[model samples]
Target: MFGRFAQFETREEYLEFLNAGVEFVGARDGEPIGRYNVAPGTRVLLLNQRDDKLHLDPVHWGYQPAWAKESGRPPLINARVETAATGRMFKPLWNTGRALVMADGWYEWKKSPDDAKIKQPYFIYHESKEPIFFAAISRFHPDALDAQEDDGFVIVTAASDKGLVDIHDRRPLVMTREASLEWLSPETTPERAEELAHDCAIPADEFAFHPIGKAVGNIHNNGESIIKRIYNPLV
Candidate 1:
């Protein structure tokens, strides 16, 4: 499962990745951001497409449709790729509501071998130090904010394998710029989106994870130091 992550890059730096092709909402210096510890149920940047133009919108980060609320289901922060395209909870978004969740990295907890009850935290980030674009699906509508409690989204997740399996059995489906652009493009078909989720996920070797202090377990604690390596990863 994926919950906590970081995105401390400047708006212009990130906008450089998407380039001049996209429009920015609240483009006035892009205030109120630079979050190093992003948790669920908070506002975050989402890159989505509408009206043949790309948009970078700050949106709520959880999804709970009216029917879900009436049914007493909690808001969803992550949606599984195994069933997202066909699942009832996400079918509405899989084809038309695809989006990109920008981040520097994410955190995961591993069970301590010495104690099953204890878990150690690790931060996973791209080896290149570039921004990560997590594939996502959303219920966001620029003109329909009232359609749900608030316009929110869910990151698409896939089963983890290779080295990352030791840290967590699942992870967010982080994608490359090319793959991310395709996912957000209106020209992509539902089948292609699903295929992209399965075929374009970044390899575990492309990411580097290292142990970090448990202070990150608390959402209230945040900063660049929060992601500092507790011990040298290479050692």
Candidate 2:
């Protein structure tokens, strides 16, 4: 499951590809700056469809369904694509609440083959170093007695492809601009939505990854330095 990612693009940079007006609503502490290490519940930019048009919006990263809150269950940060459409927690948004979680890259920890307890961190990003979009789903939460709170979204994941299986068992469901638009369109049928979801898994070869320092393990360590590559002889 994906639990950390990086989004270094400025608001203007995201607007270049989004090509839509943005409404900043859920950014933490009202800070709209780019983040180098994003975890669950972190505020991130999301592209959502509304009234036949796409809009850039800020939303919480973790999906906290009302039932989970009532049951005291943990929020979900990643939902498997294979079960997202049928899973009880995710099915509601399968066809109508699709979204795009924008990020430049993501982080995954690889266990050392030689030692079960040893793990190394790697930063994965597009070969071209451009921003990548992860397929996502969003749901609204209630603030009071039937009053609505802001929407929260969860990134979708798929079985790891050839190049990534060695690093982890799952990878984020990535999409191209065309696939993103198709997935986010409310006009898309359930069958077509499933097809689009399967088609958007980014090829592992399209990503470049390298070992990074363990500083990233701490959520408090946030900055460009957190993603800098570091030599790992074991890797």
Candidate 3:
């Protein structure tokens, strides 16, 4: 459900990969953007549209608008792609808040057969280890440059089919670079954006998933070692 992800590229590399002429606000150039464990309630680098221009900003990872505050529901790190545009909490951002999450890969937990309490962790990435852009929707501040910690966003997720479902029932809606650019473009209509969510997502076979150590389950654990492929299963 996009609860955890990693981005090991530098700020320059991420921008260059997108190459969309995006303006950076909160982030500085040449900054080391490597993050092995990105959890909820923290700032995440996002490419979003504002003022008729593409921008890169650090927006909070949880999605909880002002209207939903009284409901006492916890902030959501994910929004189902099929319903996010029509969902009560996300409808407001559907038309204008489409965005892209810059992540190298994401993690999912598998319930072990040996024990109910133990959940095995898996790392999912492109087979070739290329960068991925996860589709998202955000409730960003009106001021693009001066984004607040409360201006939050949620990754759009779709139901998994075939083998990937073994890891998790859902996976983030990842798009190709061109489709991702279109997803964030102001010219693209909401109907087309929804279509892209379903039609343009990269297939499960394009990715590979392997079991990893359980240290990633803890938010404090960070480093290349945490993502090392362990031949053995913890469960």
Instruction: Give the candidate order by descending TM-score.
Output: 3, 1, 2
lDDT of 3 by residue, 178-203 (tens): 88988998898988998888889888
What are the models' TM-scores? 0.91, 0.86, 0.91
lDDT agreement with native, every candidate:
0.84, 0.79, 0.84
The better candidate by TM-score, 2 or 3, is 3
lDDT by residue for model 2 (100-145), tens: 8778899999998889788888999999998788898987532345
**Once superposed on the true structure, which residue ranges of model 1 sit more than 4 Å away at CA?**
20-32, 144-147, 232-235
- Candidate 2: give the clashing pairs: none
Q: What is candidate 1's lDDT per residue for 1-235, written digit by digit as tens?
A: 7999998887667767756365655463554357888999888888788857767777888998888989999999999999999988899889789998878999998987777778888999988888888898987768764534647899999999888898999999987677788888888999998888999888988888889988888989888898898863321
